[model samples]
Target: MQQHPFQISRKIEYGMRAMIFLASQPMDRTVPFREIARRMDVPEDFLAKILKTLVERNMVRSTRGAHGGYALARPAREVSFLDVIEAVEGPVVVNVCQDGSSHDSCKATGSCTMYGVWKLGQQRMLEVYRHATLDRLAMSDLRVPEPAPEAPTRPAAESRRVE
Candidate 1:
């Protein structure tokens, strides 16, 4: 069987992480690519490409000079997750039938059994992502401490017999 088709691309993941790191910095502060790459553990070239796309999308600003760096084009709170993800991954098409158009309904498919389910699920997903801004994410990251590295797990024992 084919592997699941719906998976979050690594580009989107890295872009989001980079944004969070940038958002954690002061609004007026600009962070160099090297610093962001090191802190986020993303490859500098890969991150640069992602940042370039984000800059083109107007979600991030890039400066070139001896002390040049990157910063958000607007307040982190104003930049939604949808904006970042869309910049990296294009629109979020949860399913084949979830295209954004007036004529894009189950009617087009004639008889899709899961139409209602897909419609509701896709809308909820969009709403969640649309409202989830970087500021809220950064605050949550600040409040929560990073968990320690997990130790290697021991082998599982056989189940015991019931009495």
Candidate 2:
């Protein structure tokens, strides 16, 4: 399926999911990648890459050996959604015009038809993502609801409909 232009990449999504899971845990505790993958329904291999990036960015800390795992590098409130996103996917620019300075080609503000709308929207997007931290997300109840478990349904037998 075609993705929306504004949609974040899976790496970003999984990275944030892992972050929230880590944040939910006690700060001092290091949880294993297997656990994180299971809980978040993310692929372990892919999650490993995302966590490595986070570790490199100092947003997450990792430990080796059997007793080791991963944990947040700082308090959840100290890390913003933008921080995780930029860490995983580089700067989050909505458009080329949203980046650069006065006129390094595609300036921040412009006279193009979509420039004003995209610029204003980009500014708002930046502000929202910058201020919306992990702790704040944890406090909010906006998670996708888990689907209810259902009993397995048996296929109709050949004679079931025959009176």
Candidate 3:
């Protein structure tokens, strides 16, 4: 059986949730870690580690002492889903060949005819992820704003005589 590489860790889920929570709050407010943990229903310690990783990636900012916790380093619109995923999970890659390295070791590496197809699929997947941002994800209503009303048009005199 061919083992598929690359899976999104539970940490990625928790990290995204934490980011959304921060995005929903006041921009300048520092939410408590425990509060985020409780709200997200994620294990406190595990979520803390995820948060630490986010901080190191500069995706989130941490504050110390009372009334301190975490907040997004940038606006939600400025952060992409890819950013959140990469923050906790590292760079995304589906296959060994997609990593752009020498394919000399494995007997089936270069000879595999499906390598190009797999690489193309990986690129498409990345493009989709790149376009999906946290702000778009958080916006529950997907309606387009209505256009401004136009000036009323005058009816032709002949058309007004229909009565």
Candidate 4:
């Protein structure tokens, strides 16, 4: 059987998508869970569970009533990607050693050379995620915005002329 590389799963994808949708909404507005679920095409129950976790972590606030729903407790720029991920999925440690949960039964406790490499990579990933706020992510586009027009400035000898 082929071994699959460990990475963020579909749940994380759906959760992030749902969060981006929330971020897109006006800050003053509290979106209904059902509406978010429908718009994001995520299972209502699953998204609700994720939202509950976010609420517990104080990343989001929820209200109870006919008009009550969910909204970010603070500005999107104040919330980091790591906050959301950690709220729903717990800490992003890759190994038991990093989590300090190693047991005596484990044979490779102190002999793994790759552990150091993994720890370094993990730290970098954490820093990137922690520094990347939801506001930045919500505005992330691979292409640059339109550039201003300007006259060409180059010597005739160095620049190619149009046919």
Best lDDT goes to which candidate? 2
Residue range 1-163, candidate 1, lDDT tens digits: 5546677788999999899988887877788989889888899999999999999999999999988999889999898999899999899987777787643555657666787787899899889999999998874542335579999776555355557
Candidates 1 and 2 compared: the better one by lDDT is: 2
Pairs clashing within candidate 3: none
lDDT of 3 at 9: 72
Which of the two, 2 or 3, has more lDDT?
2
Give each model a TM-score.
0.78, 0.79, 0.76, 0.74
What C-alpha lDDT does candidate 2 achieve relative to the native structure? 0.85
RMSD of each: 15.5, 12.5, 10.4, 11.8
Q: Distance from true position, residue 1, model 1, in Å?
A: 13
For model 3, the superposed segments whose C-alpha errors exceed 4 Å read 1-7, 102-106, 139-163
**Best candidate, TM-score:** 2
Residue range 43-157, candidate 3, lDDT tens digits = 9999989999999999999999988999889988899888999888877877777776665534697579878787899899888888888776763322223579999888798
Model 1 lDDT-worst window of ten: 138-147
